[model samples]
Target: MDFDKIALEPIRLDEAFFHKLPKVDLHVHLDGSLRLETILDLAIKDKIPLGIETIDDLKAILKPGYRHKSLDDYLKGFDITLKVMQTDEALYRTAYELAQDAAMENIEYMEVRYSPILHTRKKLSLAAILESVLAGLRDANKDFGIESGVIVSGIRNISPAISMRLAELSVAFKNRGVVGFDLAGSEYNFPAKDHLKAFNLILSNNVNVTIHAGEAYGPESIHQALHYCGAHRVGHGTRLREDGDLLNYVNDHRIPLEICLSSNVQTGAVADLEEHPFRFYHDLGLRVTLNTDNRTITDTTMTREYLLAYENFDLLPLDILDLVMGGVKSAFIPYEFKRDSIRRTKDKVKKMLVEEAVKQGVTP
Candidate 1:
């Protein structure tokens, strides 16, 4: 049972193997994951200006890879997607499709996040936008048997007053479908401390809060998210590796880091996959989980992300299983629900591993 040796050995598991593994995605954005065809249809139907007619052209604009110049450049594609997402029907369809896509890859649990205020350009109430997304997810759950919830995000570049409003919106829908509150968007000049009011409001309401920090900025950003804002989890704390004391504090406190590999690289958070801190964080026993921050925008999926980890990081089957379980553990759900979900998913993962071991002529 030399796990390190096994991890170092070349493994031959294919896409099918990863597809069957039960997974959880704690930090996926809804507005950034619209399918290309769906985007085209929506743009045409709503007369949204995409500046691109064909799918190939749209892909070029939206599917920028990991070599992006900076976080700001990487976010340019959202302008097109968000434009078409201002309607109730568009919101429902996008949310429904995101769930269906996650279920197709055996992502049993997920928290899809978006800023409700961003969708209100069409005069739609924040409540209406939230309900539409919830209705779509609820329908997807009934149809596909995938458990899902919503995390309302407040933008960092936006006004703090608006972030406070979004926090209240999240608290208002606490049990209905909203599970957490998050602060997303750009990370450079826009500090998380600026939105302390929103995070405090979310905390006061007994709601879970995760803030985007250390992606574009330094560990001080993450420190503010934890010390000032009281974040329960951290999104893309990639730069935490730069600060030894703070990194140790995060490990000691067992705060989970939502590590979206491809998205991080695409946003210039890391030099490349080889330089990523995922292995560093995991080896240090930090509660780290892999995610596809923007599935469509990054042109990735949960399965693809797992496969990339396997190929790049040389993670063994057990390591991959642990990562999947970490995501479930880091989810913003009730303790009972988290325990039950992990129990069931672990059983399934064990069974899958046994089957794979047998197929590979290895002892289970």
Candidate 2:
């Protein structure tokens, strides 16, 4: 139990070790995280025109893990997935499958986010869209033992009035299944302040707020998200380090940044892993948590994200413990829930590391 005295350090750990550790995914997208084969299956079931029948052909077109020229370019992959998600069955199946996949990798908790308006093309009511996905998550919780919640998103590129509508949905489902409200979409020209009405409504209802900022834009976007929109957490804050003053404010406030490594690289948020600010932010004592922003689209998993940190950053067992604990703290759950998770995750990781050290013939 005396972790400080133990020399349990592994900079480059086996991927299987990462898979064995209990994990939390706080920022995965439901629409973009679909399995390619599921997309093809749903497309065939719904008679949607994907022009491809095979998974390999679909992968060649969707181009999972493809490095793109810009954030918008990286997002174009959603156009294909959205085609088959108009029905309740598609939404339910995708949500269940995503949770099942996350559970298989030992993810104990997950929060999936998406815009209901995007799935309304087939005359589905907003409430119905939300319920279908919630049902899938509920079933997955029963079958796979993975707890999950939904974060209804208001698209930044869309109108503020629409964002307000989504905010209302978040409030209506506050204790039912929805945990938080988010502003996600093209953040280039669409500033977070433009969605102030939505955030205002969300805050008035005491709903949690997390906005996508400083990824496709600069630190100024992050500033707007915090100052104007009143975001509790930031998504893909890769550019927050560009402004030292803002970075210090975030650090002092202990605002968690949901950093998605592979997605950041594919979206051109950072040039590459060497250019990523994850190591910089962590070294400065900021609350940074790793996530797979889009699992299938970015071809990443919770296990892969942790491995990226292990290989790219010089992190010790305690540092990895800190990162894992950071995720529990950033979750939108109640404080009492987070306290339990933080304690349990710390104990589990420490015990696992001790065993790993023993396996390597190190003194316990």
Candidate 3:
């Protein structure tokens, strides 16, 4: 498609994109986006020795060119971040700071996912771990005015029965800030069907379900997540581009796909920014949302992700607004909240774009 030849211009960082845009991030991972400085402090607090000490070293750990040979390889970097986040205090602070970071990037709402089961190794019960994360999210909401929802992921490598237990916990903790349930990790070997029992439980309890599929595996994974697991949304459904019928089905069903650009590229899901099917999905009337899958790990933000789309796709303000609205529409929160967010975001974007349009003497 010669995406490299697209006449898209980059939006100035503090100028057009960041200050004026309103963003909704639907697929951010809480554990994957921890701040390096915070990680260092947490490691110090627990006396856990990190091989790389300085911020630069942490950046190298995060951006290791050859380190992430595949999706599994990319996820290995999270081991250190997860290790330092064992305590309640550490979890709370990390979640709270993540919310604050989202706000700073002009994100009105975000759905941050993580596996509480992984954090339970510190003797903290599942409920306790979820509670601590919720507490941080709430505190951040109060402090930064950024609303967020938590999606508890059943690690793909985990046992089906254990995953079912997590789903039970999700259904139990529904209104307590846990918005949905997801299955993640090793997409190829651990198929979504393996976790059908857990998803069935979640479905029986009327919990929202979103699955990570079509990122590594092709359209079959997406099909399983939508048809079998009953996912309302698919995280990183990049491989769906290979299947026209499935892509059409997504649009027909109005299912949202959370597209994480740099993560997909870094993990070798898609080749890079230019080859991303974001524009194709958008043009096909599919509900595609932009996200920073792992903020610190990928060294990105919602603003940067949006800007990347804008520049790489040569998208105008209206296009960016529509993409942002797609995320808001696909959000897991209540309908009323989604409506309000879209309303406010539309007004803000209209006002900003009107100003820019007038300044540039461009017709709206």
Candidate 4:
């Protein structure tokens, strides 16, 4: 399998073929990716009062793929998901189900992230909140052989004091199924620097940090995330193109940008799919990786995200390989483990390319 030769032609694959490729999702939000039926069931079990009688009715309201007026507007759907996710059973179920869903899509690994503070609404202790999700992920790994990790997140609109608490929880769960710490939520008025104290704790303790920036805000938010907060990766860096020097710095430093393409369109980060900076950033040699920010909210999967990149950017098999390698390299797994995963991913992708070439009657 000579991928160098395959790089010469762009491969148009079906969804079924894309499903057979190995994938990673580093930026998926657990609360926003719940299954619709599961949400209804949880609501009934918890007596959460969803106000919808059937799945069709609930589906009409969610309208997962519909375009929103703004990022804030797209976030209203969370209120409904959060309502039913307050109990331990709900957390475990959702976490387990998310892992199952990812596995079905051929995602070999994923980092599920959410704010523990939000799950504490039912007077659930922070440790309980974190543990329940971990337990589900652990069980899923045992059953499906899909490796996973949890990234405890701190919301931006929330106070720094609360972010600090979430950071401490992230530190406490360090190697116990929690891979990293993150700052998520509204990026407009609230800046990443405002959560400096939490980042400081996350840093001093030698934990991985990834922040949501440059989505609602601009390049400055990404700058603050990298410079002030020390993010190893920037989530939804839709606006990093606004600053040239910083863009080069990011490229020079090899910092991975978790690009969520469809989510950007639905959330109004980009006016349309064609306007996404993914092609530009990839052309400029930045380590850009595709992800499903909120699978249900954004109505996407790892396969779908890659397909969009393939069709929209006219990507070849080699380009897909670059994205795959970038994702494995940017994973927060320990050095030796990540190195191994990268190697395995390369082998799997190479084999898949060969299989596809045979099917297409294209000799490499």
Residue range 36-79, candidate 4, lDDT tens digits: 99998988878888898788877777878779999999988898
Regions of model 3 farther than 4 Å from truth:
1-16, 64-67
- Pull out the clashing pairs in model 3: none
Report the error of model 4 at residue 166, Å: 0.4
Model 2 CA lDDT for position 182: 93
How high is the lDDT of residue 15 in model 3?
Answer: 36
Q: Judge candidate 2 at residue 223 and give its lDDT.
A: 98
Estimate, for each residue in 1-364, the C-alpha lDDT of model 1 and write its tens digit. Answer: 4333344344467789888888989889998888889999999999988888999888877774536889998888888889999999999999999999999999999999999998989999999999999999999999999999999999999999999999889889999999999998889899988998888888999999898999999999999999999998999999999999999999999999999999988889998999999998998999999899999888899998988888888787667778988898899889987898888887777677666665676642
Candidates 1 and 3 compared: the better one by TM-score is 1
Supply the global lDDT for candidate 2: 0.92
User: Which sections of candidate 4 miss by over 4 Å?
Assistant: none
| Total backbone collisions, model 2 | 0
Q: In model 1, state the lDDT of residue 135.
A: 99
Query: In terms of TM-score, how similar is model 2 to the real structure?
Result: 0.98
Show the lowest summed lDDT stretch of 10 residues, model 2.
Answer: 4-13
What's the distance in Å from true for residue 300, model 1? 0.1
lDDT of each: 0.89, 0.92, 0.83, 0.90
How high is the lDDT of residue 144 in model 4? 90
